[model samples]
Target: MELKKNPKANVGRNSSLYFAVGLNVMLLLTYLGLEHKTYETETVKADILMMTEQLEEDIPITTINIPPPPPPPKQLVTEVITVVEDVEEVEETFVESSEVGQDDIIEERVVSVEEVEVVEVEEDVEVPFAVIERVPQFPGCKGNNAELKACFQEKMQEHLQKHFRYPPTAAELDIQGKVFVFFLIDKYGKVAKIQTRGPNELLETEAERIISLLPKMEPGKQRNKPVGVPYSIPINFKLQEQ
Candidate 1:
């Protein structure tokens, strides 16, 4: 038998076909891998961007402003007022004597004598006569009235001499003033409820001291019995050269 050429064998005999098939498979695998890697990278980048934006939004910033403060109040002042009473002295009058003549002759003679002045001598020294009226005593106390008046005058004089002496500064400045003090003599003749009515501190202090040192007065009597009485004492301060 003679060898004959097979057409089918001839048909499958192209090297280029096999090469094309292998190249197509390799290209498809490479395209799929590349697409997968691109998607993963894009997702990672988007996540990172979102986290950065959120961090920026969560932080906060602030600003502040402050102002200043205000001042104080004032004080009040008061003035002092003093009241003084005037003392008047009484004048004495003398009467002349008339001489009587014989009744039948009906002649009358008037005799005039020179006025004689009686001078007051104190501590062996002569002083001008000054008449001081006796202070009338409270009613119903009888002889005790005279005694109480004398005692009160003496005590007042002594108290003035002792406690009313002012400081040299006060005297030099001529600080002459008066103060009115109010006090109550109890049933037992004790000085109580003493109060001063003026604004001068020094005057008030002196008045208080003098009033405190006063001896217990025999209580003012009503029908010969002890009774409480309220008294107001006016204290006068004057400066004289020593």
Candidate 2:
């Protein structure tokens, strides 16, 4: 015995359609809610002021006293011109042509070497210390080229140590740096043309002074001839830590 149910009474048959309809209605409601706008009424404040009568007062007119325009700048004769006769006559100078014409006589004479004055100009030649064949010999320094160079340096150091005096102001102000002293040992073995560069002028001056105290030495030679030798040394101005 099988029993048959009515197809129109099935509940789950329209469930999908009902869900789609409900979802569409929820989306429409959400859109409407989001798009809803409310307007608020604001009360305006009014201030009323009463009119008052204004009184008019007359302002006094004041006159400014100005000095009558400086008496027009007085007119006066500043200069007077007078004609004077010429007293002294100026001699007229005649310019002669320097170009030689065919009529001008030219004297020809033979020149002899003995009659010609030969001026021997001593050339001032400079050679660097490192490349010079013979380095400048310090006082009491005698040796070959290399030994002389070493001795010269040793003597220079001794001279600097003997005369090294720090400027009191520089030491007090705490100025310390290395000063490069460049000096030329002239062909006559005299230290000359001393130049210095340093962080401060005081240090440079002191370095210059120390180099100036060096004794006259034998000039450096290049190719068996004395030449001015340029030497550079650095003097360090350092203060001892307390």
Candidate 3:
């Protein structure tokens, strides 16, 4: 009546059921532990965020005072002047007497107003342009009247071409025009009285900058006397198509 199979053979059949139950129990415990830890971490994060949001509630609002800007200064206004033509010329003569007499009383004579220097306000004075007698010599220009004048013109043109620059703003806006600049070569051959007329102020500014870079040169002369020579040249600002 006892079992015919070995006892260990039946024991192996129950071993599989025991292993499956233990593995399922272990997995369930690991899942529960991970869920507990995740809940604790979320609780801590929520508390930190809530504390940050409530922190501003306990603080008081503040106001600051700002100063106002200063007032603008007043501008001076000049009076307009009217010009008049000269119609009369008076001559003044200064005569000294050499005869001295003790009985003679020297009477004072009214002096003529012609000897006095009268200054008139002028808007613009036309400076002379030097010609054959003597002409303005640009730096590095040498030779006779014809040679010097030709060299000067060549150098000036070269200078303008070398320093030609197109304003970035003007280029971006696609505006191109010719600028005419008038500058004076004074008695000392120094550039002065620079004036520019152009379609745009930016173009004029560049033209003036090119002329201002001129080196000190031999002054222009008229009848062997140093004089101011007004010179004018045109500069073209053009942008090429891409």
Best by lDDT: 2
- What residue pairs are clashing in model 2? none
Candidate 1 clash pair list: none
- Listed in order, each prediction's TM-score against the native is 0.36, 0.56, 0.48
Candidate 2: where is the Cα deviation over 4 Å?
1-102, 110-114
For each of the candidates, the C-alpha root-mean-square deviation to the true structure, in angstroms, is 36.6, 7.6, 26.3
Span of ten consecutive residues with least summed lDDT in model 3 = 38-47
Ranking by TM-score: 2, 3, 1
For each candidate, the alpha-carbon lDDT, in order, equals: 0.63, 0.94, 0.82
lDDT digits (tens) for residues 1-242 of candidate 3: 78598776676778889999999999999999888843334444444444545444567769788888888888989999999988889899989888989988899888899988999874333345544356788777788887887898899889988888888999998889999999988888799989999999888898899999988888877667677778888888989988
Query: Model 3 segments beyond 4 Å from truth?
Result: 1-132
Clashing pairs in 3: none
lDDT of 2 by residue, 1-242 (tens): 99899988899998999999999999999999999999998999999986697788999999999878666777887897999999989999999999999999999989998998988998999999999999998888887999999999898899889999999999999999999999999999999999999999999999999999888988999999999999999999999998
- The local lDDT score (0 to 100) that residue 22 gets in candidate 2 is 100
- Deviation of model 3 at 172, angstroms: 0.7
